[model samples]
Target chain A: MENKMGYNASFAEEVFRNVDSGDEIKMCMNCGVCAASCPLREHMDYPPRQIFSLIRAGKREEVLGSQSIMLCTSCYTCVVKCPRSIPVMDVMHGLAHYALKKGYTPRIEAARFGKEFWNQVYRRGRVDERDLAQRAYFAGGFWEGVKKILEFADVGIKLVLHRRMKLIPEKKIKGISTLRKMLDKAEMLDKGRSVQ
Target chain B: MADVQTTNQSILVVGGGMSGITSALEAAEAGYDVVLVEKNPYLGGRVAQLYQYFPKLCPPNCGLEINFRRMRQNSKIRFFTMAEVANISGSEGNYNVTIKLSPRYVNDKCTCCGKCSDACEAEIDNTFNFGMDKIKAAYLPHEFAFPMRYVIDPSIVETEDGKKCQEVCEYGAIELDMAESTFDLNVGAVVWAAGWNPYEAEKIDYYGFGEYPNVITNVMMERMASPNGPTQGKILRPSDGKEVKNIAFIQCAGSRDENHLPYCSGICCLASMKQATYVRERHPDCDISIFFIDIRALDRLEDFYTKVQEDEKIQFIKSKIANISEDEATGNLLLEGENTRTGEQLRMTFDMAVLATGMVPNKIDIAGAPEVAADEYGFVINDPEKAGIYGAGCVRRPTDVASSVADATSSAFKAIQSIARR
Candidate 1:
């Protein structure tokens, strides 16, 4: 490996100011408890501990491009086990949201799934499982979408028989517009929080 | 004589560990009258339990033996084992102290013969070995227990087992009805050398100290390596008594963390490194890996770190082990962590694991003495202006044997100065 350049403070300063609970990473002594306790650590390209180290080392691209931040299942094991009591789960979620706002889709599948989930709630004020499933499965293309739908055809039949899904197009909930306004307001506030 | 009449000039040393021994001997050798009180029946507190010291790997008894000899020949020193300071009053020059002495149940007339232990039926956990084994109720503290006498367990003193031990004593050493007593001594200054207790490893929970048969603390590891340990000089797994071929030493088990001991115990890094050699020497093929946040072998001890680092079989991994689990069937331990230096996720198995736990200073409550301060972590803070009481050794900070001796010598000198100034 080549000799790394000296630590740059600008990226860390940005993370501290904009990312939620990002300032708490300053307390990390690199003990690796966060990574060890993370249930999703094996799937992550970089573990939570290394993510924090990258943030400190000013590897902006490596940190924002890491799938580790988006892979958090919010298990809370890292949060509970951290010797420094760092809010690890919150920070990981915060990073995932931040990456999307910065136009960095580190993992497109997770980003697309999150967007579909949000769109379903915003449009109907409640999720229509059939429609949400269709959107998610078809996001790849026609053939891939058909393959996924066929793979889950049995489960879909089981849901309709169980009355969990309705064949008729469901109407919007009673207060759909009010819920959308509240969500929009919340999004505006979240955007303002990062700017300040 | 043109001298102001000050009250008592004798000094009182309140613990009989390495520090207390040094303080007592240094003052007594300087011709100042000294009284040393210890809570245990024997004088050597924690060091006597060590297999060997660090750096040179010299046996602790080498230094302890010299101090014991100096203590024995010095006529100015008077000592009491199984005693505590109940109360202290007055100022720097003339302080009245009440010493509470617990009954050993065996007096000076009884020589250490094996007859009492042979006859005694009651058995208790041998704490000297961290309860890894048991000893007869009527037993000596250890093989080289000072005062060279036996101690009848107070639990047995009331039962029929007590009568058997009493009757078996050909020397009339067992005193079944010995009562607790208190006495008063006026001393010019007091040296509070009350040492330390190992941080409770079980409290960490994730390390599975009490839950796993193969996980042991650093202090317990020292006893395990000793010739007189429960295994009799053999480093064997506690669950199966099998010889260990691989070991993992988890450093900073309870130190340098906000949840546990927040300060770095100055000696644990070196102590663990020293213990690594203990395993390597006995089982030359034993693979040892020490996982640590930092190898804090500061000062001259850094050279020892360099030497240990040079060993091909001993790996110095820079990571604090996150947790440990036991493989129940084989009685092996699984250590989990990510090696920070390499970013490699580690889930390694070993025959046994030693948790490098830190020290907790034994609380000192000197009633009616000057207001003694302690830091947030409960280490005693000695006020230089108040000359009556001095906190030395681990009571003041976590330190090794050599530093404790040096600190004790300074306490001894300050104690003499307090009297002379008076």
Candidate 2:
């Protein structure tokens, strides 16, 4: 009851100015279509609409620390259903990407899986399912990783038996050195994009 | 010899719906000759299709009958059904207009006896009921059709059944050899009452309108509630003949959105509210839920909205429906939205769903239609400088029935002024 009514305009401004596709949230009319359509809404600290509201309210910690922003699977259900044509999926993903760069760790496993998947993509030219699975499974440290692998052992065996994934420590594609150079150049260009 | 004569004094009213009919009557009653042209088999048009009107919730027959009586009493007004304005030449006080008439097959000799419909075997969709029911190949347009004529479907004209019906009729009303004819008239001014059509529901893919049999549009809901409707005013689910107790009315179905019509259709909020009465009248205990972004029960209609609000069974949820899915196992609809007030995420399943689809104006895109302008939302803009042309009713802008009538009379005055300019 004693709390002062205040909003963090700087945080909102930062989001609009720096976060990719963050400006799209300005179109949100608080219709709550995204929250209702979201299957993972019950598990979130705040729904997509609430996340947008929090950002506007200048509740910087609540917004940046929200698991809802990080939990977007990019299903595009919210994207198509938005009456204002707000790219809700892109905004959520952008917020998640921005949060990661700001040194905020996601509280949800889905976000970690995404980070591992992206890391594997960054290191290799293409994904080796085995390598990607190893990183994703081992993300929670040795004990949890072993439990996860054991849980998915049947599916892994089926994939292996079907030759869908090979046991080999997947060989690099041709011209790996050139690919690395191009990736590094892209990263450098991307990093310098916001500085100006 | 020094005096001048104005030869073209007649006003032409296009579209035979409420506005067009009112416009013709108003101008004609003002001592000017009027010609009314419609593209349907009957003159009543869309007003005749409605089960009831808003505010008072009076059946269209009450008003249309009075208009029909006025048309009958006034010899100054000449009306033609199944006709279109094929061409327009000249301007303002002196104009040459061409009218093309589609043959009704059943001539003026028709007594509206039950003989033709009984003798005929072929069935067709009864458009008056919005295709909710079927009519015979030879049938009356509606119970209150002006000119009181029966139209033989062009399909049955060459068949044996047509000849049989012709033979069975003692009045000799059926004319199998009638052909489409075109004629010209000199009119000083024209009133465009080209009305609106329901926004196409299929385009809102998430609603699953065509995909789900139980999901119906607001207009279809109107048809269903009519005594002459598909299930004879039972409010039954279209998938099965079971009565619907849990119904959801989704407002702003295709209006007020960037992806669809950008303008608020001006009447859907009230129309859906009126439709709630349609459900509540039959099933008093029915739990009718209306989901809307805002309750825009404007002006005097707000009284009726309050009356409906008093019903505990009829609850209002503040949310625009984004998607609707059918549960295949139950054959019921799963609607997802939110109660913004309660901040509660809504995942509701209903017996049937009514999508309150908004109005889309009928475009005056024909080759010879006058150069009347339309605003961004395709609503006709009546340019005052454009001499003889005027857009009335929903064609000018989306409006309710009461306003459409008032609009018709107002445009009639403009048309009269245009004709009297000489």
Candidate 3:
């Protein structure tokens, strides 16, 4: 955690120019309403409002490495309740994405799960629930994955019985190629500039 | 009263608040004919509702009394209560104004005797107290109300209880049949001193203002502390009438926020500090916390901020309260937020919470009125070249009482200048 108190705007400027909707943080008055409104605030090491405060104070490593960035469920309560009308959810998700790209794995499990989820959508036009769940469970390693799957054995059985998960192998949708082309274009655009 | 003589050299001052009264009095004292109109049944406006002013902490009545006395003695100033400018036409030195007058129900013969209210059984929300209590349908606006007259609620005019009130009036002041009327005025200049309305606290859902009984706005707190207030000057929790041992003053409730009043209200910080004294005066040991993003004491008022800072019981938290939730068991409030200075999350409970809500400018929407442009936030803009039309006081911008008086004086001077040019 970079605790140097003197304001260094270099990192803030970088985040503003590079992070998606990062410029919106400039409007924050540090009112703490976003943090209070956040349902996941208690679980966060640095709540949404505090994260913005840290960002402005030039705590670049602390902000990027904080697990709070990856915990956004995107319920959008902060965005709607923000008096400044800041896109708080977008900023958090943007920071999370930016952190991963910068090689800071704050929450490795969350990053792995996200990568797998994205891969599923890219490979198959739609996510195969059963296949995605197994892939996510196994990401930590085979033995630990088995233990985690065992912990959710009843949920898995219930899912299969409810017909929410198919026993057969998943099939790619008819328009998989078109979807892949659109995703590729999105990636290309993302690489060129931040997409709100 | 209908034949209020006015001409091309006369000034028409809209609103009867401190600003309007000052504008009218200043112009009239300068020997210019001035006509003052107020939508309320009496003058004083929002200032009348305040328990006391900041810095000096003197009662608003003292200032209001002087203005009322000046208004009463000024022969050049003709004033009307329960009146509004319905329309304005022409320009500069030749403006024709149509004034809408709502019936007072009780005529000038009113002795302000409490008999009518005594005989009246019909009750209505006492807006003077921000509807914190109920009053007889026929009652005075307040004890210090100018004109010292009684007004009858239109809802009870045709009811039997209203008839009883009319019969009990020995002075024959009750005129239940009084009808709404309109009249015309010719003026050289128009000064819109239409004051401000308290920003709707209920709109900020996170504060739980309307949802929580103990949570009230700063304006309501003024009334709560006033001798003539709903609780008769008792600072008691609304739910159980228990004296508050701990109170929270949440500053900038709806001010300085993009979703609310984006402009800083300029007075709320000092107002909250002044109110903290009200709590400490009643209960010396009472705990008071003022939550604010920043303390905008500004200019000379910084001394008052220092004085408040000296009080150990009154703590100033450098954080905007995130939200407030009520403890249904005790009707106490739990305020949630982070102390921005320490980066520590806070969840403190208080006996009551006062939301330092900001002021919203009253809408100047008179049909046929001269073009007076307002800023994006609806504060009337002062255009130097907009002929004789002028905006003053809170209507033009959020200001303290002293600043409002000064702004109103300037408007009066401008109005006189416009008339002199004519």
Candidate 4:
């Protein structure tokens, strides 16, 4: 075992100096509030509390590669109820973004669904069910999309009959620039390029 | 004639922490006679523990210094440090309070000389340092501590050294012999701003705070990261004294759990994110991760979370740690849990861990204090219409410093209304 005596004075000083308002990371008292309240705790490799420790200890790559972050639905259940108000969902999303950008393949099916959703939203002004379904199927893989194509035929026919399906894609919204700007800003902030 | 009426016109403010101090200052400044009672030896509360505050660059000393000056200048605000309200009688604007004050071996006459500290032969865990460092029996709470005085801990003071401390002190500030005293006062209104204690880690054995040397709490992290703290503001593993390469922040350690505090303590999530940023800023090469169930950023706080996410050095995981154990040889932390989204179980290791403990109300139960009501969680129940009896800061609900100050100001306005009605 390591001699639990010395501390890093320079590192601590630097933390004190550079730690901004959002950087109010604290020490874990080992209370299991995060794990107990986590809606996705049952599915995570390392629960919220452990994830925090990993971050504090500077294990960023391991946490980014972990599948635990991809499972978070961003429900804000833990955040609303956290006694410490640690922004669990925000942290999870931040890690997911990092992992995705770093080329860490998400092991969760839900993540693929989210990627499809994002792509749909980015490419098209509005989400169309047929387009979304097609995109989701394709993104999931060719075999999975092909296998689901038969199941989707029934719904596709109904949508066409009801005129709910758009054949040529809707007109681009006028506020796309603003939306792009906001998304870009969010991405930049999530990447920690600029402070709010 | 009418029933004999006792004019208990004094207002008693309990728990001389930041909220309590604000409440006392606000009420006293309104020209009401106030009696402020503190459980600790000093007046400044958790805010004093912080190295620096958010939204503003002001240190705890900067804001607290102003409050201290106001407290000293306002004679109407009578305060007792190391005191607690033993019992209470009467109701709304007519409370008879008995305050039991613990002894402070040093009196007001002594200057802040190091004689008592030097002469004393006692060492104990410094609560001010969050137990990271030892302190002499005779010591100042912290740098720029209010009253600028040194205190001798009777619990640790040796009999022979206690005498020597008195002899060495030129100003005669050391009082080896002191007694706990009880005093009674009548008050017209009472503001119970008794703040919160970080949820104890022992309750949740999964995180292994007491069992693991590297596993600490958010409060301990605050002290560890504070410039005035034990390490002089260094982030290192407690077990090996090695520079931390990987750190993890576990949020909602004792909060938002049905088995513990079901309600959100309100600040843990932001606090962890802020701490992550702290680590990243200090050790650019260091890797940081935050595990949380959700990111509960209400309104503008979402922006803050977004900003933290942008730091490439920091990572966030959306899992609640189900188990934690220390590696016997390396002192590294081993954590295990399932990835809900992927339906896969995983494990990882880290140099140190932090549990984001929640807050619990100080007043678990109080008799004869019917004028004040508490929620199911024991937080002081706030009535927007009620006058005089005001709840501010964490006592009312979990909030950040800015929100707590706003609550104090609002409570002050309500108190003003009550006095104006008189």
Which is the leading candidate under DockQ? Answer: 3
Candidate 1 residue runs with Cα over 4 Å from true position: A1-7, A116-126, A135-148, A159-189, A192-196, B1-8, B89-91, B365-370, B385-387
Segments in model 3 whose C-alpha atoms lie over 4 Å from true places: A1-7, A193-196
**How much native contact recovery, as a fraction, does model 3 achieve?**
0.69
Q: What would the TM-scores of all predictions be?
A: 0.91, 0.91, 0.96, 0.67
lDDT by residue for model 1 over B1-422, one digit each (tens)?
A: 11122238999999999999999999999999899999999989999999998777988887888889999999888888999989888888888888888988998888887899999998999999999999999999998888788998989988989999889888888888899988888889989999999999988988999999899999999999999989987889999999999999989989988888889998999999999899988999999999998889888889999999999989988888888888889999989999999998999999999999999998677656556678889887777766678888999899998899999999899889889988
Which 10 residues in a row give candidate 3 chain A its minimum summed lDDT?
A1-10
* Chain A TM-score compared with the true chain A, each model in order: 0.87, 0.83, 0.91, 0.65
lDDT of 3: 0.90
Tell me the TM-score of chain B in each candidate. 0.96, 0.96, 0.98, 0.93
Q: Sort the candidates on TM-score, descending order.
A: 3, 1, 2, 4
lDDT of 2 by residue, B1-422 (tens): 01122248888899999999999999999999888889998877777878898878989898998998999999888888888888887878878878888888888889998698899999999877767778999988877778788889998999988998899899988889999888888889999997999999999988998899989998888888888777888899878778888999998888877888878898988888888998888988789999988888787879988998998989999987767889897789988887777777788999999998889998776786667778988888778877797888999888998899999999999999997777
The structural similarity of chain B in model 4 to the true chain B, as TM-score, is 0.93
C-alpha lDDT of residue A120 in model 2? 65
Better candidate by TM-score, 1 or 3:
3
Q: What is the DockQ of each candidate?
A: 0.66, 0.60, 0.69, 0.04
Worst 10 residues of 1 chain B by lDDT: B1-10
Candidate 4 deviant stretches above 4 angstroms = A1-196, B1-7, B156-158, B384-388, B416-422
